[model samples]
Target: MVLDTVMTTLHVLVGALWVGSVVFVAGAILPAAVEGALDAAPLEKIADRLVYLSRGSSVVMFLTGGHLAGTRYTIETLTGTGRGHLVLAMLALWLALAALVEVGRSRLVDGLQEKRVRTPAAEVTTVFRVAAVVGILLLVDAGLLASGLALY
Candidate 1:
């Protein structure tokens, strides 16, 4: 029971951070930059800080979420069970993670570092658009799973 409580707490906290940060970055921060309302250098700096924050939160979510699901929930329940919501939530998480790593870290960073973008304005806008969409999806997924409404 104690372990259950601890794990639940960890899972909830991590999930909230993971989801909330993504939402804030995507919905609030990105839009401002994309609209050219924010300066490019400041936006880039914010993006860097957001990346760092996301890394830490994602790591915690991955670790705690794995433990919670693996220890508290059966594999059958997660996959084969009639829990379609859980399945969808899991799939969304996976997709979000993929977007973060492949698109955000690798592709976005590579483009930025290589000076592939015609201007800092263009690059910032591009990154903001992609991150905003992906981040919003990730947040929704985590929020659903964390709420326990995803279970069968």
Candidate 2:
């Protein structure tokens, strides 16, 4: 029971950190950078730092989440229960978030290194929009999971 509680707490905490960072970047940092209110250099630096944090937190989340899933639910439960469905949904969201962040970071780096040329605002906006949507959805799903509604 103690182990279960610890794993759950770690999973939620790390997931929160990951989602919070993405939302902040999408809602604030990207917009400011795209609008020229922020410098490209600082934006790049922030992105680099966030990439490390996001990736690290994601790993922790995966480890704890996997443990919880493996220990708490059997294959039958996973396929037959609402909580299991939520788990699957969360997994898909995680994959989507990972792809968006990795691809966006590469593009951001390319834009930043292009001889003082800013990455096109439209491109950044697209990536930010997609990430923000995914992040928001993840938060909502998490809330449901926490509320036990995911077991419905």
Candidate 3:
């Protein structure tokens, strides 16, 4: 029970951190940089930290979510129920979110290598926005699962 609580807490916290950071970068930081309000140096630092956070949070989510799912479900159940499908959808959303982040970051990194802020920010803005959307979907999926909506 204690382990369950701890794992759940970590899962929720890290997921929030990951999603929220993505939203912030996409909505606030990127816009500012593109508008020439923020500099490339700070943007680079933010990108660096975001990459670490994204990688770490992805690992943490996989571990905690795996433990939770393993305890709560079997292969048969996961493959054959509404809740199971929701879990599967969440997994898909999670992978999509991660990939979007990686792609955006890579573009930003390559653009940064050219020492241009607005262009890189402009380049990756759409990718990050899509990631933000996926993150939002992931959060909504979690909410549905938590609200017992998936039990239908």
Candidate 4:
């Protein structure tokens, strides 16, 4: 029970931080850079931090989420119930979000390396948007799973 609480807490915390950061980058920082309100050097630094946060959160979530699933679910339950389906869907969203974050950062990093900022930010804006959307879906799925659904 204590393990469950700790894992759940860690999972939620990391998810929120990573997702919130992505949303902020997509909704504000990227736009600011595109509009000439920010510079390439600072944008590159922020992108590096964003990538680091995303990677760390992804690892933490993978471990904690895997532990939670192992403790609470089995092959049969995971494949045969609503909550199980939600968990599976969340897993998919998690993978997609990870990929999007990596790819978006790659775009920004590559652009910054080539001595450009606004263009790269503009190019990667849509990717970040999609990632943020996926992250939101994962959070919503977590909520649905937590709404007192029967545990298997």
Q: Candidates' TM-scores?
A: 0.64, 0.91, 0.97, 0.96
lDDT of candidate 4 over 85-106, digit per residue (tens): 8888989999999999999999
- As a TM-score, model 1 comes out at 0.64
Clashing pairs in 3: none
lDDT of 1 by residue, 89-141 (tens): 76576456545633443444444454433344344445545655665665566
Poorest 10 consecutive residues by lDDT, candidate 3: 143-152
Residue-level lDDT for 2 in candidate 3: 95
Please give the RMSD to the true structure for each candidate, in Å.
4.0, 1.6, 0.9, 1.3
TM-score of 2: 0.91
lDDT of 4 at 135: 91
The reply for model 2, stretches above 4 Å from the true place, is none
How do the residues 19-99 of candidate 2 rate in per-residue lDDT, one tens digit apiece? 888888888778777677776678778878878987897789789989999998888878899988888888889878877
Candidate 3 on 9-86: residue-level lDDT in tens? 999899999999999999999999999997777888899889889999999999999999999888888899888888
Please give the distance, in angstroms, between residue 104's alpha carbon in candidate 3 and its true position after superposition. 0.6
By TM-score: ranked, best first: 3, 4, 2, 1
Q: Give the candidate number with the greatest TM-score.
A: 3
Off by over 4 Å in 3: none
